[model samples]
Target: MMQTVQKRRTAGFLLVISGASLWGIGGTVSQYIFEIHHLPVEWLVAVRLLLSGLLLLTISLMLGNKEKVTGIWKQKKSAGAVVIFGLFGMLAVQYTYMASIESGNAAVATLLQYLAPVFILAYLLAVRHTYWNMRDAGAVLMGLAGTFLLLTNGELAGLSVPTEAVVWGLLSGVALAFYTLYAGPLLAAWGSMNVIGWAMTVGGAAVSFLHAPWNAAWGSWTWSMAGSVIFVVIFGTMIAFWFYLESLKYLKPQETSILGCLEPLAAILASVWWLHVPFGLYQSVGTCLILGMVIYLSLPQKQRAKPAPA
Candidate 1:
């Protein structure tokens, strides 16, 4: 039994790292597609959501979640929640991250999005869901200092990244906070696969009307572009999400979330090495601080680690 449990834990660790790293690489590939091939961000978003959603739903069926696959739509409140999550939460997160990448490098974009936990903590305090504590305050301060340094290179003269990129990156962080909190109830109700599948499908369908995924004429359609898009949709979206949800079954939420730092690190490395994006000393320190905030927040307080429902 002990050996079995140990093996599961190992699997969970590997899964989290793999999933997060894939997401980081996906962002870089998306940047390449956008910058080099001039693909429309909206088109990519719409198609990615739609295709990934369908694939997830199919996986749910294969896993004997047939009941959950169809049960979500039968209720009024859940149905409503799914739709709202799809649009405002999932879609918002996806769109803003892509927009930030288009406006700036993937490293900065991803590190900024890691500010989600900071936003989540702030929201908890604002709503009186969590009480003020010194540790929480410290984490908040760390995140702020990191952001300041990252944006202005530790000097208040100006921003190292574009203003538009910063705006979209910050928005992505906010959307991620919303996504995490809003997803709790849905995951509790219908399982992660079911909830995510439906949310992505709904979000994708909504985006399709606005962006029209069928139109690829706006961008240069090369074999590389096609391959990049396929990679983003398949391995990045579907496999990454699957690994995340599966890891939850074997590891505590805190463990998986802390390990998620791998995502941004992968993005930073890929950006600098592959894309030749700048990463100066100040920015490096700032990256460490932001990542430290994520690690600190993931640590257990007075309470024990909570198991994620998924």
Candidate 2:
């Protein structure tokens, strides 16, 4: 039994890492589509959410608890919660992150969005009345230092990217924090697929007007662009979400959050390699510091660690 449990935990960790890595690659691909193919941000977001949502929902119907899918709207509170999550959590995170990527490169956008942990920490302090500790302080300081170095490139003044990119990236962080906090109760009540699938559908429907994907210039679709779009929808959106959520069964929420930092690392590498995004020494140092914080926080607490055999 112990061996079986350990195996499941290891598998879950790998699954979470794979999901995060895929998401990072997808972000870089999205940037490519935006810069080279000139794909409109709104249309990409719309199609990704809509198509991915449908695929997930179909899978849920096929394999998951069909009762959850059908009875999702039976309860007024759950129905309302799903709508709110879809509109504020899903829509905001997706749109703001994409906007940041459009305004800047995937590296900067993803790194900036990684500040979600800081925001979440602050929220816990305020709402949950949690006590401030050395760990929290260290994490906040590292996050601030990382953002400063990444944005200014160690310059005395001004940002490396446009002011708009900074704003969008910061907004993406806020949206991510909101999504993380908001989805907890919902996930506990409904399974990952059911909740995420419905949330995506709601968010997509809400944003359908802006993109108007039906009226998009389909004539511009090339083989490369089509491949990128399909990969983003399938691997990035659907598989990524599914794997990450499945990991929650074998790992604590905090552990999964730490593992999710893999996304930023992958994004930064992909942007530097593929997009030729200029990454400075200061940015590299900042990335290391932020990653250090992630590792520190992810360490098992003394009380939680098991004793070795005597």
Candidate 3:
């Protein structure tokens, strides 16, 4: 019994780490696609969401979740929730992230999106769903301090990256926070794949209507570019989510989130090595502060608290 439990825990850690790493490197692959192929953000986002969603739904159906795959839309409340999540949460997160990358490099974009925790804390505080606490304050401070360093490098005279990138990146973080918070109940009720599959399909379909997949003018795909796109859709979006969610069976959500820090770390490394993006000392410190504060905030609070493990 003890050995089996240990193996499950180990498997969980590996799954989360693998999922996160795939997501991290996926950003770098996207950066390459944008730089080399000049793929439009709208086209890429549309293709990714739609294809990944379909693949997930296909898997769910094969796994005997056919009922769930079709049943989620039978009720108005559930269907409505899926629509909201798909449009505002999933679509926003996906679109803003790609936009951020287009405006800036992958490293900054990934780090900024990591600020979702701070946004979630603020939202909870605003609604009185959670009270103010030192830990929350620390998270906010760390996020602010980190953003300053990452963008300004402590000069404060002007941003190191384009102003537009910052705006998109911040929006990405907000959307991520909303996605994380809004999907909890639905995911619990409908199962992760079933709910997210439909959400992705809905978000994809909405975007498809605006920027139809058949109409995509994403640059001519070379062999390498094709491989990269495939990796982004298959490993990054679909399998990454699967592994991350699957880890939940063995590891606490908090533990998975903490381990999920590997995503940004992987992105940063890939950005620096693969893309030749600069990562100076101050920016490095900022990244640490941001990621550390995130990990800290993920910790179970000393006092009783609402939301998360705390």
Q: Over the stretch 228-299, how does candidate 1's per-residue lDDT look in tens digits?
A: 999999988889999988999999999999998999999999889999988888999999999999999888
| Candidate 1 backbone collisions, by pair | none
- Compared with the true structure, the alpha-carbon lDDT of candidate 2 equals 0.87
Clashing residue pairs for model 3? none
How accurate locally, in lDDT, is each candidate?
A: 0.91, 0.87, 0.90
lDDT of 2 by residue, 7-36 (tens): 999999999999999999999999999999
Q: How close to the true structure is residue 87 of candidate 3, measured as C-alpha lDDT?
A: 97
lDDT of 3 at 1: 98
Clashes of 1: 0
Q: What TM-score, computed on C-alpha atoms, does each candidate reach?
A: 0.95, 0.92, 0.96
For candidate 1, the TM-score is: 0.95
Off by over 4 Å in 2: 1-3, 298-310
